[model samples]
Target chain A: MLTLYSFGPGANSLKPLLALYEKGLEFTPRFVDPTRFEHHEDWFKKINPRGQVPALDHDGHIITESTVICEYLEDAFPEAPRLRPVDPVNIAEMRVWTKWVDEYFCWCVSTIGWERMIGPMARALSDEEFEAKVARIPVPEQRTKWRTARAGFPKDVLAEEMRKIGVSVNRLEMRLAESPWLAGDEFTLADVCNFAIANGMQNGFSDIVNREATPHLVAWIEKINDRPACKTMFAHSKSEFADRGRKVTA
Target chain B: MLTLYSFGPGANSLKPLLALYEKGLEFTPRFVDPTRFEHHEDWFKKINPRGQVPALDHDGHIITESTVICEYLEDAFPEAPRLRPVDPVNIAEMRVWTKWVDEYFCWCVSTIGWERMIGPMARALSDEEFEAKVARIPVPEQRTKWRTARAGFPKDVLAEEMRKIGVSVNRLEMRLAESPWLAGDEFTLADVCNFAIANGMQNGFSDIVNREATPHLVAWIEKINDRPACKTMFAHSKSEFADRGRKVTA
Candidate 1:
């Protein structure tokens, strides 16, 4: 009844993947590996014109954008465990965190991830293969990013990105200190979205994110990792980056 | 009691302001003049730590982010008219457009706007006054943007921004040709969020958004403008840029 087009359980892909698990929803998982540029292929583009992943196909309808997909699941299947809060004020808080991840947190993590991991992977491809792959990307900005990744992101851009990550991490630390979760006492989609990237911060950004520097953030990551649903989501990884996706959570 | 702290009926501010009008809700409007750096003032920052405008205080709970505020209005005031579609698929579509506007469209428009309009305003200030204004901005990125605007945005950056605007406009035109409103037959928040920025494009960036090039978008604008609520919203403008906000619809 449901099929999720995702890139395993990391970054944007992990948001919906974890949400589905937490909601006790069983659906097909169609992995669209970014490493091979499968997301930009014609078949994938047919499903989503923009060719971005973490899209949910319910029956004949299609939904893109990971945060939107999470909200869609909440809207379409109301009987599922509510990842969204019932109180209007709490819901507003949930959304602020979700939007924060989309606009601020995830991009910083992705920029660093692409620079450290994806850049090497892209650079490994043959010149002919690389050019062909870059040409196939549907979004012009994404294509530019891919080329930049392969060539190496500018040092200043990376530095600024790292600085942003520091700011975001510190904010998370401060927020978690005040409340049990990003949106207050209850676990909501805010935690789901933030953890998708925050989990990565603990591992890849150890220098900036650790018990000594960010004890609250570190504790929250552990709390999220201890969940049964999170375990299932991590174990659900089937892509080539399965190890990378499962590493911190495993 | 509902109280909205906004710049005016334009850009991000128009989203909640127009939504309230469409819902037929009466609320107190607190106009925060950005030209005078009121948003960065201590009192405004107490309302929204980010020092961003277009924040809603429902009763006493504070809500920030223009799109999130619009959704908050929908959730908090369910008895009011629904700006969101009842169907899950349609809600997803509405969110996609809203998110696109927030992520892709708004920044480009704002970049151009600041360069053309705010640059002159900033340049007019005395050297000491400009530095003092810049120092008051809480967010580092916003402070950097203000400094950039005063220095004049890079020629290539503005050119690139224009190119992106053209691409976004063309996409809107193509989408409008197929759907009656952005989310389908229903006039949803997608139209509400988009028309806020699109209406400005028609007037300020006529070179790219004329009726000849974007008939469907132009028609959609006229359709939205024809709404009595839109007329009321334009008339609700109280900032220094009131005329600029009301001009397109007038």
Candidate 2:
């Protein structure tokens, strides 16, 4: 039995959620609400000291980090459809894409998520409530980001974030021109990981990666969006703030 | 049969260099000197579009990203000693360590490397030459960082980076208290990846993780340092800038 602890439709949570969906694996979603600071609660920290979501409890063998957790599901549960490629070279190629999400694209998307979506939600909270919530964030960097976003992201950082997003989108467009999938010819974990972040853009910043600017990325997003797993996963993902992001995109 | 393009031992390059040593695999080390901005040369861009180091070209197949490169070495050259555990669960555990290097620690260490070490090296360049060198850097974000570091990292950013480093170091101390190695009992790729960053701290910030503060971590670093593979890797790692880092630590 596998249980996945995750937060929302926008960030790292969606990465493993999509992986579980693509592989058609059965997992109980123990949704941790970030808006309530449930992840940083003492109870949750016992599960993961880092207090990050996308932690997996596989028969009490705990695993954290969405990247590791996604691959763990692929490795541990072989009966499910293989989301990672078998060839080592292809696997290496696939990993680069996941690295892109974890290291770069996630930050760009998250900057926008905080500024446009979550920031508004946080601003709506009373000063005492917001300061209390920010203080509870386990990671200092995140606390600074959330607090800053609530105040409003400076134009420079937001501008740089948008530029980075453009670079990510442009690179994706160029890559899709070659291989049908991010890893190669077949759908794999790379697609699942990339789709998690790309899906957010479709609703929240449609203009950044629409047909005109990034035709290949837009087409790729559309094709992946239509997948049964994508539909199923999105229908189930939860977040008070991200739900609004979904509505705005819708 | 293999070619590895890299620069600066302290950053991403040390990761694969250590892997190659641990596995006893010999690849052509096409050292791209960062001090002269050789990595940003047009020829180097053909090897890696991002103009980052630690790109491995196996025969004709090119793979970039230090995380992928390190694992690819294990997968392709199976005759060598295995740095990754065979058990899937252990493998998952190992990946968390590498993810820490890639997503968190790399930034912390690199922030210090820029502000404390390489920043001085970059500033030593003449004005026209420095401007020319900066112009060649393909990635805009990196160019900004390089320029910012040359001017000396703003106090606030460096303060935040140092705080992040403390967080990463504290987490390592806690994990080492539990297990002998980052990936449980075995010396795995996790060690190679982390050592790349941690090795730098021994000289640059010795007080932060010495025996008194984190006995386990200090002992762990010393043991890993004494490994024949690490010795051999450091002996051969080439970069004008990193050569200085090595001397400082030595």
Candidate 3:
């Protein structure tokens, strides 16, 4: 059986989960908690030295990197469905769009969601609790370095990142308006990647998504949210979020 | 015949040039001067709206993005030697290596070659010459934005980028030490991408690569440099570089 190592509520992990569910593939899911840094443990590092999820272990062959994993699944399970057109020109278009989704869209998710929203949410602590959390870092030098880097980020930087998010969302809305999915009429890997990150963005930061500003994008999100596979992944993820006592928009 | 719109001395442009030359595909080459922002011209934008060079017009179809262009050439000229393997695992491995070469190795090249080297070269200009260059931008606001961005980068940023180059060079050295190429024993698109960028990096920054620091990587570069197709691309690019008063290091 295939095993997927992932953490709940992570955009990176959601891509593979969505792909697997869409294909109706059966797999065992093992969750990693980023809050606990369990991914950095020696056992997990053996699977992925990068210490990032989602990592997939198919039989004995281990594959890491979200884009790489997605490609692998497409190849391994050709009977399931095609995520890209077979023709060279269409494949090229698919690849470029997939790359764009990963690079630009993923960057927006990291900058706006993780850095701006998630980081602040994680750090919402009393002064004593904050000091204790800082003290708990295994390496003192690393703690100091992290603090310095965090302190260097100006408020304007976050604002600029949020603006970039708006620009990307607008671009995505325009793209969705023309085609049902990110890559024309088909629900390709591009849509899977976009769906995962876009879902997180809309849910984590509703302020960024509104009918007035991004009506088309908001509607597209609803369309994807209604899919059976998406609903299943969202329900499972939501249960995990509830278990952790964190509010989940998905 | 295929037509390639390109500017010499760009790492991205070299990918398709090598692919075309290696596959013995006939193509007409048009040089666009980045210094004048000729790629951003309305005429050029119709071919590639991103306003970046190294675009290919194959028959009537237009293709942009170097990686996609190379893959397109491979598919179109399948009778020519296959640049990518057909097997799933091999294809996945090739994709992984290609992505790494594009993302990681290209980062080193952009940081070490363009951002670091090109700025000092650009800054040596007289005030009138610099102003004239800035005025060539079609959009006034874009010109202001470009000027401000260029003025903001410090020398240390380039130095830090060079350090990253050294780290990547070391990793490549280890990878090449085990196999004849970047991916494995076979010479695929991975080798093509690495050769193009490594050639440029060696030309601009010698300290990052040497017999001692990257013995295997140096050997790999020497082997690829000896290829007739690579030699042709290198020689053809010379006049373009000489026109810029910069020595050709392809």
Top model by TM-score, which number?
Answer: 1
Candidate 2 chain B minimal-lDDT segment of 10 residues = B241-250
Measured by lDDT, the strongest candidate is 1
CAPRI classification of candidate 2: medium
What ranking emerges by lDDT with the best candidate at the front? 1, 2, 3
By summed lDDT, the worst window of 10 consecutive residues in model 3 chain A runs over A238-247
Which DockQ values do the candidates obtain, in the order shown? 0.87, 0.78, 0.56
Q: What is the CA-based DockQ of model 2?
A: 0.78
Ten consecutive residues with minimal summed lDDT in candidate 1 chain B?
B241-250
What is the Å distance of residue A29 in model 2 from its true position?
2.5
lDDT of each: 0.89, 0.84, 0.71
TM-score of 3: 0.86
Clashing pairs in 2: A203-A249
Best by DockQ: 1
lDDT of 2 at B128: 87
Cα lDDT tens digits for candidate 3, A1-250: 7998987545778888888888888888888776565665668878876566889898877877777788888888889867766777766777777777665667655654445433553466556755665564554434553354344445786677677677688778888778887767677888787777777455566787777777788888888889898889877662343243235344
Cα lDDT tens digits, model 2, A17-75, are: 88887888888888898767788888998999768898989898888988889899887
